[model samples]
Target: MSNSPSRSVIVTGASGGIGRAVAERLAADGMSVLVHYAGNPATAEEVVAGITASGGTATSFGGDVADETAMANLFEHATTIFGGIDVVVNAAGIMPLAPVATMDLETFDRVQRTNVRGTFVVSQLAARSVRAGGAIINFSTSVTRLQLPTYGAYAMSKGAVEALTLILARELRGKDVTVNVVAPGPTATPLFFEGKPQEVIDRIAGANPMERLGTPQDIAETTAFLAGPARWVNGQVIYTNGGAA
Candidate 1:
């Protein structure tokens, strides 16, 4: 393994969930990491602290992923501080559920702005900033395939993400940059567990042949693979869903 500390990465939404796990995993892999948070500075700091305590290099950054200016600045800062950026994981997002029949325009817009626009903005910046041999990993959801009720807007946003991922990979043709998306199914993050009853959760878990919920670490390992050794896996949507969907 060419685990080089000179390699640096930016992981957005690193304050919690899969983002945090990616940050930690990259740090352990000898990559300096920038832990980014949308609004939770404290959680971001905690991640940074933990990495540094374990002798891994990491720092915290804050920005709204959907804000072009903010994202641009975040990229500039990462490049400036780390000498150059080798990877970017756009893991920041928001998910709100409402049936399409009764879904408010405001809620739909909110989902689009954050999930779709945020991904577009981050991917654009990453395309321009990442060095050759780098990877740009974006987040999509397996829900896009599962097509669960009340997830119409979310699925639509991720469908767009799938489009962006494949197109971006082709566009980066000679740059040695791989663009891909990770679509997780029924992860056990606080976000996934928020309001669902145990019975509901159990049913969802059983839908997958694995018969269990996925952990953030499960997704993080894939991010590590793509960011480092999986150079040939370009423009692919690797489903880290334990065979769900």
Candidate 2:
């Protein structure tokens, strides 16, 4: 990692939603960004274009987050482009809601592959390569605490992610790199709304004290804090939900 004047960050799943918001917010904060997408180059390019139009520095990359070689290549590309990476946000995750008993093995395994293995791969690279003062932000979910039905597989995957992130934080001691998990509640994104009925959404939105679902910007603010000044907040899962759990 180079000691550049401005920081550089890699935001996986940054083509849309919370990841996209994080990438944009960090770029607005003056860090060069590498927007990463799993299967969507066009959306990633849109994100990059938006950042560049706003006078921020950004580019796009595509890779399978769960694939070790692909993610390793991603890290190398970021280093090659930005001189060095200072922050890595493991925001790439997939949530497939299903009862553990009824869910097939394929779905459950897919969830783990993307949410757990994906985070591990990116985090491993970040742990070794991120600058001394860098940070690693991993995504979890409040469903782990809520224990909601139909969320068993998703919650289990996120649970693994949380554990991995916390342990990584301790492992990175003396390296000045902070590792933390951001567990969000029911946020209004395509991912959250997918296949969920309107009544279910309304009920969830009203369950929180805020009486509304969390927006992508709400999550992004927390991420920005972690990636920048919240150096002491390590090894903890900060829930970004509106008091939902």
Candidate 3:
């Protein structure tokens, strides 16, 4: 691995929203970033271009976090392009809401596959590859604490992430690598606003103590901190929810 201060970091789901913000922020902090996306090549390229244009180093790769081969390729490319990775942020997730009685099994399964299993796969790779003094940041949600209706499946998935972070931290005890999770409140993202009426959106936003939904940048800030210079903080789910949770 290169001994340069500019370390390499990977941000999964960097096509848009919080993932994009996190990738850009890390790049701005002088890290060589690997921006991973699932299907949106254009968006991923846009992120990479934005970083490079700003005099930072970044590259975009398209791969499903749930696929083992794709994830292997992602790590290989990261190491090949920017040297060994020092940080990994697992920000890829899906939230499809429905009452448990009415939710389709397929949809629930997909949520778990992407949100829970995807984190597992990426974290596993990071465990084997990230250098000492590095960190793994996983995504959870404040909804798990809120216990909101129609979010059972999503909360369950994040709960799994919380458990994973705790266990992984213990497993990595002597490695100087910290494992943690970030649980954000309702954020103002395309995914959050999709299919929701204005009234419902307003209510959701007002539900939080801050009286407004979070911005992608808000969540990104916490992720950036966890990835660098937050080595003493580990095995904890830091909830950045504007005091809502």
Candidate 4:
């Protein structure tokens, strides 16, 4: 592995939940983090502040991961601020659950644009910009295997992400870059529990084998492993769920 001292990482959707947790965790591990948020600059700033306050290095930037130009600018900013990127965690995604019959085409398209296209835009930039021994960690969900009825659109988007991971791993065969995906099951993010009744949330939690919903920190630990010491592990979608899938 490349023993570069500056170890910089870029994390998308860093304003909340899994993204926020991953950014903080990576920074704590002594990696300079670039926290990327699509909106909510205040939340992004808060994440940066928390990391810096804890004696970790972090900076926040805003850009839509779905837009190639915006993603390009994000990469440029990272290079300017931290010299270069050594890892990228693509954590930007949305899960709007609606049965296929009732799901609006526009909503479906939005999900695809952000989850699939956004991941592609960022992963490609990571591939081109990150140093030789860098790692690219993409987000996926265990819903693809669970095959829930209302999650068709969301699962489709993540399915594309899984395919992208496999192909990117092959494409970067000799460059020493590792591309992998982390699939979490029923994480307890605001996005997951938003607007749900207490009983509904309880049932969802009970459904998991662990009898509790996953925390952002749980997912972050997996990301940190993939991003850092687990260099031998590559081209695999490691499911970090507590056997829920």
Candidate 5:
């Protein structure tokens, strides 16, 4: 891994949640990371600060992942600052739950634009820009397989992401750039705990064989594997769900 520090990554939604964890983890693996946030610069800066404090290489950038122009600029900035891009992680997404029968059209569209369009924009850029031996990782939910209620729109959007990732991996054949998805079960991020009582949380936790919720680091570990050492693990969905499905 002596050549690892020369590698740089662009991680969308690095302001918090799994994205932040990924930024920190990848930086620890000796990669310079471009931490991106959609709205909160302060949070993103904190992630940057933490990495630098630990003697790691990282910086923060902000943009709407759904905007091709903005994302292109983000890629350019990462390449300019880090010398070149090696990996791209599309962790920016929004999940608003509403049953399809009563789901607001506006909310549904917003979900599609941010989750589906955002992943598309980032993955498209990564396909063209990421260096060989790199990886493009997209986020999806185990809910797609679990078929949970009120996740119709969110799951539908991610279904498209799964399809996109699989095909993009093939399209990049012989390019040495791998494409994959990380579908996590109930993770214990603050975002996950929000608005949920202990009973609900416990019930969800008990459903899994792990008998607990996954931490951000759990997902990040799997991502680090794909980004660094798992070259042959291409074009697949690695469910980091503790066998919940």
Candidate 6:
């Protein structure tokens, strides 16, 4: 087997939450990581610091995941820093909850732009750049399956992600690169807890057979598998929701 240090990953939105966890996990497994952040450079830097402190190779880059030029530059920058790219994880996204009837076009467009367009832009770059046997892991949501109220727009964006992931896997035929999606359900991130009442949180948690919210580490474990050893699992969505379905 090739040495683990030879592999490198670009994880968008790596400042915190699932992204940070994924970056850290990949680094711990001996892959170099590019911790991409959209807005908070400090947090992204902190993630890099933590990785380095653990004797893991990591660096932080700032850019909008939806911009084609910016993302291309990010891919190039990561290559320059790490020698080559083996995994691309589209973990950067936004979630705004509102019923379809009450949702304004601005909010709808914003979510679609970041979640759908961003994934497309990143996947396009990854398709063009990933090495043979590399992996492209996109983020989706279990809400796409649960179909809860106020998640219409968010679910719509993730639905598009699922479509993109499967099709891209086929497009990369013969390249030995795998494209897949990781759909998390009600993860215990700061953004998930905001504005949610304890009763509401508990109810959602109980809906899952595990009876608890998923940690960022839980989602990271799934990502680590797809990025490294799960070659046969391509063009599919792995719902890491503790049996919420």
On TM-score, the stronger of 4 and 6 is 6
Model 1 per-residue lDDT tens digits across residues 132-230: 889999999999889899889988999999999899999999999999999999899998988889999999999999999999999999999999999
Misplaced by over 4 Å in model 3 are 1-5
Q: Candidate 1: where is the Cα deviation over 4 Å?
A: none
Worst 10 residues of 3 by lDDT: 1-10
Score each candidate by Cα lDDT: 0.93, 0.92, 0.92, 0.92, 0.92, 0.94
TM-score of each: 0.98, 0.97, 0.97, 0.97, 0.98, 0.98
Task: In angstroms, give how far residue 14 of model 1 lies from its true place.
Answer: 0.7
The better candidate by lDDT, 1 or 6, is 6
Clashing pairs in 5: none
lDDT digits (tens) for residues 1-245 of candidate 4: 43234899999999999999999989888899999999899999999999999988898999889999999998999999899999999999988889999999999999999999999999989999988788999999998898977899999999999999989999998998899999998898999998779998898788877899899999999999999888899999999878885
CA displacement after TM-score superposition, residue 237 of candidate 4 (Å): 0.5
Clashing pairs in 4: none
In terms of lDDT, the best-performing candidate is 6
Q: What lDDT does model 2 reach?
A: 0.92
The TM-score between candidate 4 and the true structure equals 0.97
70-169 in candidate 5: lDDT tens per residue? 9999999999999999999999998888789999899999999999999999999999999888899999989889898777999999999999999999
Model 3: per-residue Cα lDDT at residue 215: 97
Write candidate 3's Cα lDDT for 31-103 as tens digits: 9999999998999999999999998999989898999899999999999998789999999999999999999
